[model samples]
Target chain A: METFKHLVNILAHPTIMLTVGMLVFLFFFPPNDWFEKWNRRLRLNFLWTKKGFYFVMFLMVVFFLFGLTDPNFSLIIKKPDNVPIIGLIFFVFIFLWISMNQALKNDNLIEAGEKPEEYNDPEDKVLVWPDLVYIEFIALILCMSLLLIWSIGLEAPLEGPANPAESPNPSKAPWYFLGLQEMLVYFDPWLAGVVFPSLIILGLMAIPYLDTNPEGAGYYSYKQRRLAIPIYLFGWMILWVALIVIGTFLRGPNWNFFGPFEFWDLHKLVPLTNINLSEIIYIKWFNRGLPENILVREIFGFLIVFGYFLLLPPLLAKTAFKKLHQNLGNFKFGFFIFLLLCMLSLPIKMYLRWLFNLKYLIAIPEFFFNI
Target chain B: MSDKKKSNIFQRLGESQVWKSIIRSGIPRTRRQRMMSVLNSVFLHLHPVRLPRHAVKVKFTWCMGGLTFFLFLVLTITGILLMFYYRPTVEYAYTDMIDLGEQVPLGIMREIHRWGAHAMVITVWLHMFRVFMTGSYKPPREFNWVVGVILLTLTLLLSFTGYLLPWDQLAIWAVTVGSNMARATPFLGHEGPGAALLALGDINFVNIGSDVKFALLGGRFVGEAALLRFYVLHCIGLPFIVMILMAIHFWRIRKDGGISGPT
Candidate 1:
């Protein structure tokens, strides 16, 4: 019993242990040399198709095993809270990785000006009705059958009648909104719930319009779209998915922080002493108290925020993203860069909230504005 | 019976004027007949006659879009069935749901409706992701992509508005947490950013009672009014909007050169 108890104690601390293990493993494991062996094997006549098939099978097996063995598997699926979101996030990442890997393999061929037929579908292609429709119809049947069976077994949750007087201690929005809900902890409600979400939607809408890249159409290729899609998806993972994971597994009652295996306690409060940049500058740099005027006090904040958002386009046009800048002219370039900065701000703010307890860059409580 | 006799019966049926009138053609033996089989049927006209062999490949397309449309059908059918037993009143809503699950005819319809709603949300997201990753939204297809985005938003809105219909704690709190965000819309909410500015010059242009939040909730808080509003939105309003948008979306896919293949 002691040994079993000790095993749970040691094994359940995945976050800390995994971080340590990863650092240690990476320090010794030179990834370039490891890949060189795979390259040599590939040159010795290993088929990429076979390799990819085996690799996917291997991943599926590993995932299946992990699900079976993970102690919190039940909690992850059975949800009144967001444990299922955590599970879905992991699965989503795995599929994303596989998709990226598949896309990457054909990237170089695309760059080398390979014909579309050589890589994927021929230009003069197949029909839509019998070919696509039959498969679609079959898929519809399979999906409906699966959902019906699952629904029969698992009833959707319905608790008692709502009484406005008794709100849940940590009332959650729907699983998708949990990411934004989590953000509300770090930023003001307006910024997290309203502005950032709007920005995400706007950015998504702007993708096809702004991204002038002519390659990676009708097929997936990481090389062809090495810049745009991956960067957007990676940012989405960090900002939204990561936040939801934290909100699901790491948050406890009273919106307190907790480790993965930590028990939720109503009173498990972590003392927060957050200070704004303006306040810090006022006291530390000028050796005086902060001003009451919102305009005077937050001018620096506005400059910092807008400057990063606005100025980066011209900077990119001159430097790292010059090609992109030329591809998409001034208007599109500025808009895209602005969207990127907004997306990037979520993670930046989250880190600041976590590390320094920095509440806001611009906090205007009089107008209920905190950013 | 002999194989020849069976063929004679089928041949006679195929040649009969009545059969010709219905089928507009004889038995489908040739490729042209196979193509006509799709064109001649009103129900089958939604599909293009014969697909490109490439279109059939599951991995390339992932069939995610089709899967989403299929799930929408499931949700619609099941939702209507569930609606037959449901009552939107605060007193009767939750009870009706329980009774529908336990005592009503095809009691499982309630469960199917609930689960199908969840599945619809998942499939819509997957479809959007698949489309984005494939870069199928470029050029003339851009507007279709925009329509797709609107449909996606409608999917979420439908799911959210439907969440409140159960009248349960989960439904209530979830919606409560969600609608509370509206109360922070810049010029709308009493406590929102632009509201203070709007309050100046001895006059208030906007406040909680007269803003987007009020219109959304139908009151200061989520209660009976909110439930009824959500019900209308979920069952009739949003669904009506989505149906029209989906029609346009599908039409545009055909117009935009069919599910974007390798060029």
Candidate 2:
């Protein structure tokens, strides 16, 4: 049990979790056909099949029940405010599994040169009065009953009255916005709170425009939209949902990370010496004091930041994303790549922070500018 | 006692002037009558008279969109009830919240409202996911997808603005942390990039007093004005916008060929 707890603690580390998430994602949705045999043997699609899904769900339930045995885990999980998140986890997974199961099945049928399950004869229609309306009525009743039961079972959380002077040790945003709050650890409020959120909305809106491929219209088929599906899952599952989970359960007092079974010791501190790019270049590498001039001191930092955004697009256009560029045209390609890079930057910055204690790429507090 | 007598009684009731005026469509027995039942009713008319069989399937639609709308209705009704006892002012807000749990009748409405709000957020997200997975946002439905993305943001905003209403530490701190982000709104914020550029040698344009954060909080900090502003935005402003957008979203579904299907 101790060994198991240790293993979980290591695995739950953000760096490890994120890396594992990416690996699992790639394993499921490989960039090439190289892992086809491995994928088949693993039965990636079978994981969403009824029997496989039940087994996975059983494991999750067991794990949760087991975790609840530990006081630390139970305290976090059983919190009234966190209850919706628990439901979110289950519902998200269930719906994801359901959709993926259908998608995989549809993909197989399409490969066999048949229509998807959603294909219905237009003439063979159902009246809204009974068919649609009845289903809606049933759903509404079910939802209402569920809400009533939940309301009766658990009380809504109301903490102490408004105290302006003393803030909570780990002040968290509402569950939905927790992902943005988590980003504050690795980024400035400007980038994490404002810019990324705007980009997310814009990018979601841009999906229909960007993804001009009309192969999988009105049906669930992963094979038809392999690229689009994985990218979106990465953003939604890893970036958003996973971040919220970490923020809610893992983060402890003073915004420190706590393991599932570990106690959230209020006094516990992790010593960190975060260093800026200028400090690394001037003081550490050159064995000299930093330059007095701000621009001169942060020249290398600015060059790298500017180079990443400006130069990398053309380089990608010529190499990796050449086909994408050709298909999307210049303007659309540039916009798409910009959005993609912005999304990818989060992980890159996170890795930099973890590995090197790198705080900022460009740090010029004179103008309140940093990246 | 006879089948004919029973039918006659129901038929007579259905044929009454009051029944006709209220129901418009008589007790639907035939296919045409069923279609008319949907067509004539204001609430039911939002849906088309007939839909492709697969469109109504739980597997395909997931009923997430409908549930989200239903949750919104639940919230609005419960919210209006809560408003009767609760005051948005800083002095009364915290006590009112406590009273809601202890003194108010059917005080469980707060729990339902809170949970329902959370559920709505989840449902909206899932709805989007289902739409994306099915490629329902293609071609004619592209604008609707954009509208949906906007609605998703509004849903989050709605939840966020409502978060501050309880006038508790959780509410204030969360909003404070959240609204503090506005202080980094590029040129308009005091601590943001390019704020210094908008200043003369001796005079600064944007500072703590006049920055975006100041405008958002209505002061330098989370206080009375901030509470009132967030209250109004939460109850009225955001919901008003969301309703308009939701109308457009539902309207577009009909215009965009009544939900995407394999062509």
State which candidate has the highest DockQ: 2
| lDDT of each residue in A232-313, candidate 2, tens digit only | 8889998999999999999999899888888899999799899998999999999999999989999998898789889999
TM-score of chain A taken by itself, candidate 1: 0.78
Cα lDDT tens digits, model 1, B1-263, are: 23466468787788789999999857766667767877888866666775555567776666777777877888888788777888888889988878876787656776677677766776676677777777888887898888888888788889889889998888888898888888788877776888878866877878768777789989988888998999999889998999999889988887787767676
Interface RMSD values, listed in order for every candidate = 2.1, 0.8
Q: Lowest summed lDDT over 10 consecutive residues: which window, candidate 1 chain B?
A: B1-10
- Give a tens-digit lDDT track for model 1, residues A296-320: 8988788988887777768878997
Residue A14 displacement in candidate 1 (angstroms)? 13
Q: In angstroms, how far off is A265's CA in candidate 2? A: 0.8
Question: Runs in model 2 with CA error above 4 Å?
Answer: A35-38, B1-11
